[model samples]
Target chain A: MKFTKGRLLEKAKEISTPRARRMSMTINKTDFRKSMKKLVDSEGFKHLSTITGIDVGPKIELIYHLTRENLVLSLKVKTSKKNPVLPSIVNLIPGAVLYEREVHDLLGVTFKGNLDLSPLLLPDGWPSDVYPMRKEWAPQDIRKAMEKP
Target chain B: MATRIPFGPQHPALKEPINFMCEVSDEKVLSVRPRLGYIHRGVEKLAENRTYNQNLYLIERICGICAFAHVTCFSQAVEEILNIEIPSRAKYIRTILAEMERIQNHFLWLGDVGHEMGFNTLFMYSWRDRELVLQLIENISGKRVNYAMNTIGGVRRDITSMIMPSLKEGLNHLEERAKYYTEMCTKDPTVLRRTVGVGMLSPSDALELCAVGPTIRASGIPRDVRADDPYAAYEEIPFKVITYDGRDVASRLMVRLDEVLESISIIRYALDNLPNGDVRVRVPRRVPKGEAVSLVEAPRGEDLHYVRADGTEKPVRVKVRAPTLANIPTLCKMLIGENIADIPVVIAGIDPCIACAERLVFVDTATRKRWMWNKQELRKYATKWYRKK
Candidate 1:
């Protein structure tokens, strides 16, 4: 079965406040699980493309890129920098295991149920608690730490 | 008791650094765990610091083999935010370069699989043909590897009539070789023993794992970025999405081989019906505040880039999701319950580019020792062993 963006977004709104735009849809973090559930059930967004973790000011924004056929849907979820914790959707979408671990490694957001939050892309001996993707970890800070005896 | 074999962050079978810890009993793999981040350069974080134009070069470096795919995906995302319509000629040229890259990448993967399977004759023959495509690419873009041909609005160079004659000749030669290779892959018994029904992935498992590119397609699902979501000149250009239900290494080889034939036709069609117009348009440094997602069908699978601009010279964020990242979990799924000896062929079937997917490693700075084991208990065991020694 084929679906237009409007039809997909309409089904998506049942679980969350998904305001559909030109080519994509944006959703709130609060309704993330519900919206994702709805999309998977009705919108055919079974394929988890990739997750993008960005350090936006006070929060780390995680964008879940999901696709079904030609239609692409990106669900934006944000967690505060001070206490970054989000529900792990690995049970719902198993393919997200590596991506979630990668976000945790770089941005320090914990995906609660993800059994292995060990570093996905950071080097060994990279200091604990230093999230390189975070805005606070400046270039000079990394250089200083690397050169330290 | 199951014996654990830690196969390569560096191994003879693996071309790049990625660790796979498998528990085997009676030579069959009980389970497999993949450890990534052996070469994480933090390319995503670095993109935030550089301007849109300058980052083009950096993004291309993400994968040496799939360099053009990265540039095209990045440029398309940036162009979407700016809402600039690239010239028709530019679209055709972009499509041409993309197909050329696909040919080189597939042939390279085929050759690598041959090397892994101890068929050096296939490897030599495939790479010999690959060199022809690389030469044709060099003829057009003037650079073999990182053809910095794609820019924001359009492309850096135009495809001229002077290059068409030789380019067509090159494609014709490649077609003949592709036919020969296709016949060999089907008829060859040694290839059959290594690939046929070795690593099985059901369609349901593939979709659940969210595998992309040819890996998923080999499982009997026709999910292709180009066919599903038309990018560049894909809508105007015609091509078939190749799929095989063999659900094993053999299916993957056949799918890739078939795609090479399709790519030849697509490139030939684009060149023969080449549109005439300017190749590039001047894009402003400061892009408007907006977010855009661009998906390109790279040789491996889907190449995706997400761009966010806050009315600045440098982008607020640029997120890249290479295909190998999406397919890694599927590879893990295939590895489980398979013979340990099938590891190399199964992994090679995915045509994984670990350099593009991985980023970091675990190291104990105090002891100056790398974390060989993923679990804390295993790390503890290693520490105790070291202390005893």
Candidate 2:
């Protein structure tokens, strides 16, 4: 019943590109935490639906889907593949802890401030460096890594 | 001394495999750490290799109870990327099957919860009623557990008028039973004793933790994705977003019970207004380079599916965020400050769909003594503990 006015869209323009749609915005990796804070505190984007971390050739794209009533704003941030590290939003939104760990487990992206980056959905003795979701890991590669030394 | 209890990877309460290491002093829980991924099949990575339609079947397998929800959300996301508008009748049929799945799933959870609380009478009756509901679903889709009715473009099957009579009859029966169960759950002293004030998640905590479905709704959120985002025929179908302010195990029970009735009404509305047209549209295998996120209000909560197609037969990436995973943090939060005897009821509060539930091995920190209890033993201990109270 409660749909926010364009306040989030307005605030999103501060750090994102002009190509921002009504439901999504592409923000620079540097302004990721700031934009997430502004949206959560100012525009009522408190409910983080889920975080989708995808490997995009040279970069890893992390989309934080924030929902308030009917409005779902996809806040997309791109971090380099070589050094995929981003500020942890668990401080701002504590619910993101497991999701951050899931991303860390599969994509090898690091959430700087999230102390508990333990493997969420992987075997206990699974290799630390091998993230199966990355494009380089084939079906056979995942199986090979899981094989006991 | 702070003793530790490792709850599961083979939990006896919720019948699921996931571990929770709880630090407790005597019977009082201090902190809980959840270790998941026991059943992790790597479906997300698997989805990237398979074609759009192949991914449809794979995603649904993510959850046995809410299989159709995953398929619906996955198919809808792929349809969005293809920019294909499915027929109106397809939308109506999708809603019907979805609500049917919700009805069946809630009944399963109801039976499971009753079993968890040492109340086999409620469990037996609820499971009996659940079978009839499953028959209605099987009659339409020919398969009960993982109904492959949904395809990329639309649903693969249609609900003809010939099947309407049986569907209506089944729903009428479910409605009566649902109302009775609702009344019994609200008034029953034993149910009240086990559920009331157990697993308390405040409105702010729920919203902050991003709790979904009946879990958050029970906390008085009223944030159902069906009403909010308006997927399938939900925008046209009228229904109430059930909410309860109790914010405990009882409130969660009441929310689901009321929602079962709401879902029945939704099914009735969709069936009455079932439109006439083709059920599905033929589409190309290769989707255009695009991305979309689909959210469905499954029986447990909001089920999410995100798809990014790279102009190929296989998708670039597919992400599934099941409702149970979303509520784990809240589950961990609720486990704290509760008696060890009340562990099963609290874990079963969120209606977790897994292999085993209610297994706890207690380890004394100072003396280094360890002991274990199975699901039945734990349930019996809870009964005796409550009897003493």
Candidate 3:
């Protein structure tokens, strides 16, 4: 079934919140999971390509990318660094395993029940407790630390 | 008991540095654990600091080979966010450059695959012919490696009629060479012996694993981002997504070869029907606060980029999901129980870019060790340690 951009927006509006229909949403992690699962089952959104995490001053926003009937649905979840955990979607989409692991590894967010969260792209001896993508670290600091024996 | 052997981080045969640890039992791979993040430069983090215009150059540097695709996708995402429409002629130009990149990339992969199988003659033949495509790219973009042609609103360069004749001749030469190489590789008994039915990925496996590009097509699953989800001038231009039901290294090779032919055809069509208009549209300086995802068929498979902007000079977040990253897990799955000697051929089957694969960083709890390896090094180590007894 082919869907034009307008039809997709309309379908999204019928099922998702107004914010989600506009390709954005702000929901708790638990509600985010439910909304995503609902979209998956009803809309046949089988593909979860990757998860994008952003630190928005006071909160971390998690974007779950989903595609259904030719339209992309990005489900957003906001959480604080104090308790950064989200439900694992590995069970829903097997291909998302590596992507989920990556979100866990880089953003320091835990995906509960994520299998094989082992080191993927990072090296074996990479220092812990330091997230390179965090805005605070300087490039010189990373280079100096990397140059260390 | 199975012994675990570490294959990379530094090794010959791998063009880039990548590390893999494999468990071998009697010369057969029992399981493989890939250690990545050796070369994570924090491109996403870097995107955070750079202005929207400046990030264009940084995104192009994501991978030298797929630089065009990365910039094109990034540009498209930013354009979509700004709700700007590119000129029709610019769209056609972007399509032409993309197909050109595809031709050169597939040729590069062909040569690499031949070298992997110890067929240096084929490698030399493929690379020698690939120069023609590269020359054409240099003629159009003025730079070979990182063609900074794609801009936020449209393309930085235009395809004028002055170069139309040369482009057509180049396409003709490439088509002839593609045919010759495809026949030589597919008909040769040694090539067939090494590739046919080796590292089989069933259709179900390909779909379930969400394999893209030639990897999925080799398994008889026809899913091309260009055709399935049309972007750029692909909607106007017509091209077939080639596939093979064999689901082996040979099948993947054939799929790419046929795709070379299809890309050539598409380029010819786009150039012949090239539209005339302004080269670019002016995009707003600040994008609205929203998120957009753009997918393009990077010479490899599906190249995805997600951009979130909060009406600022820098993006709030940027995530790039290259095709090689998605195919790695599936490649690891195919490596199991295969002869150690065939590892390189299977690994090259995906035509992976290790630089793109190492986009994420991992923290090691035990020794506090952090290092990154590019794609080439990873394969060399896997073959050297695992292929050798």
Candidate 4:
């Protein structure tokens, strides 16, 4: 099947916002896996390029960037920062394992079914409860903690 | 018994720091689990603190080999957020520098591969020719490694007529060397023995694993960010997306070598059709609230950046997805079921950049006093020492 941004929007039209040469849309937290599965199964998205997680106040947003030919489709999902657990897409795209691990380490998000999330980009002995990427820790607080001899 | 072998945070074969816990049974491998984050500097977190313009300097240092790729990607995203159109001349100049970086980077990777395979002659020759590309870069941008050429709306530098003659001469020499290396990689028996059929990755596996750049192209997939989604002057310049179906180390080497030639031609085209205009326009310090995605074909593969602004001078979030990180899983796929002796070659075959892949620590072993330094301490020291020098 010829995969294009238009074809991807057809399946998740309610969530997708069309941009120039690309489509950006926010899917419900529950529909992320199924929406991604349908797109991949239909060959509408040939590649799971990268998954980026950003912490925005009380919620954490996850952006899944998928590409095919010249078209890019970004799927966004927001999970509450209090319990930022989302479904693992590794079963659908095994390449997402590392990215998931990275997001988990930096932002305190959990991807269920991702068995090996024991720190992908953070060193050992790093404080387990501290998510450095989250905004709750002010620059001064992190500096003070790191500076304490 | 499946004896586990630890391959590095430091090893003779690895150019950067990475550890792979390989479960092996009598020299055959079972599974390799990679431990990363030894070099992660919290650049994403750092970007949230720096302004849009300052982030270029911060992001470009993520990978020295693909420094231009980082800046270009960051600049493109910021420009998109501001909704500003860069001049045609700036786009052409950006393409020229990006391709120059590819040539130098491919040369460096080829040399590293040769060293991995115990081919010292290949190592020496590739680095020697790579200096030529660096010289051309130095002439254009006044620096070699971190060419801070990309600015917000466009590039910071321009190629004048004064340097065109020597630039063409250097490119011609590079083209000849690339052609020779391509021939050597394909026909040399010693190279074939180590590379041919070793670390084989089929097209389907490459796709499923999300391999980018020449790694995926080597597996018979012609997906190139430059061709697939034309950025900078790529839409205007003509160049073939080189691919090889060898599905092994040899194909990967051949793909990069051929790409060097393609980059040379693209550079030539950009220079010949050089547009006349201001190289850059002043952009506002504060970017309006919006999000932008910028994708560029870095030397290794597709370099992706996502920047979100909140109508402030600083970005709300900046995410950099370097190419090497995407290729790591594919590296694991290639390593399994392979002979332990070919580990170095196979690993180098992916052009793994651990610096771009993980979080790192610092140890001063010379004093026999080993205490790990935090990312901020090391970054401050490195920046102060380097900039002062």
Candidate with the greatest TM-score versus the true structure: 2
Pairs in steric clash, model 4: B37-B359, B38-B359, B38-B360, B39-B359, B39-B360, B40-B358, B40-B359, B40-B360
What lDDT tens digits, residue by residue, belong to model 2 across residues B1-389? Answer: 89898877763334468888989887788998999988788899888889887888888888888999999999988888888889999999999988988888888888878877888899899999999988999999999889899998888889988999999999999999999999999899979988999988899888889899888898998888898888899989999999999999999899999989999999999999998989999999999998888889888898888888889999998999989999989888888898887777788888777523456787888989989887677778878988998
Tens digit of lDDT per residue, candidate 1, span B336-362? 887655666787889995321111233
Q: Report per-candidate DockQ.
A: 0.60, 0.64, 0.48, 0.71
What C-alpha lDDT, on a 0 to 100 scale, does residue B15 get in candidate 1? Answer: 47
lDDT of 1 by residue, A1-149 (tens): 35554665443332332222224556666777777788788767787888888898998888888877655777777788899998888887899999999888888999888998877777777787788888888766876876675
* Reference-based lDDT, each prediction: 0.82, 0.86, 0.77, 0.84
Each prediction's TM-score versus the true structure:
0.90, 0.96, 0.88, 0.91
Count of clashing residue pairs in every prediction:
9, 17, 21, 8
- DockQ: the better of candidates 1 and 3: 1
lDDT of 1: 0.82
Write one digit per residue (lDDT tens) for candidate 3, span B196-220: 9888898877766677788988999
Score chain A of model 1 by TM-score against the reference chain A: 0.80
Give the per-residue lDDT of model 4 (tens digit) for B1-389: 56565556753334568777777676577888998877777888888989887898998898889989989999999898898999999999999999999999999999888866767799999999999999999999999989889889888888999999999999999999999998898788768877889898989999888899999999999989998888999998989999999999999999999999999999999999999999999999999988888899999999999989999999998999999889989998998998766667788898985321122332223443334433234334433443453
Order of all candidates by lDDT, from best down to worst?
2, 4, 1, 3
Clashing pairs in 1: A121-B359, A121-B360, A122-B360, A123-B361, A124-B361, A124-B362, A124-B363, B37-B360, B40-B359
**TM-scores (chain A) of the candidates:** 0.80, 0.86, 0.78, 0.84
Q: After superposition, how far is residue A75 of candidate 2 from its true place, in Å?
A: 1.0
lDDT of 4 by residue, A77-133 (tens): 899999999999888888899999999988889999899999888777777677888
How does candidate 4 score on lDDT? 0.84
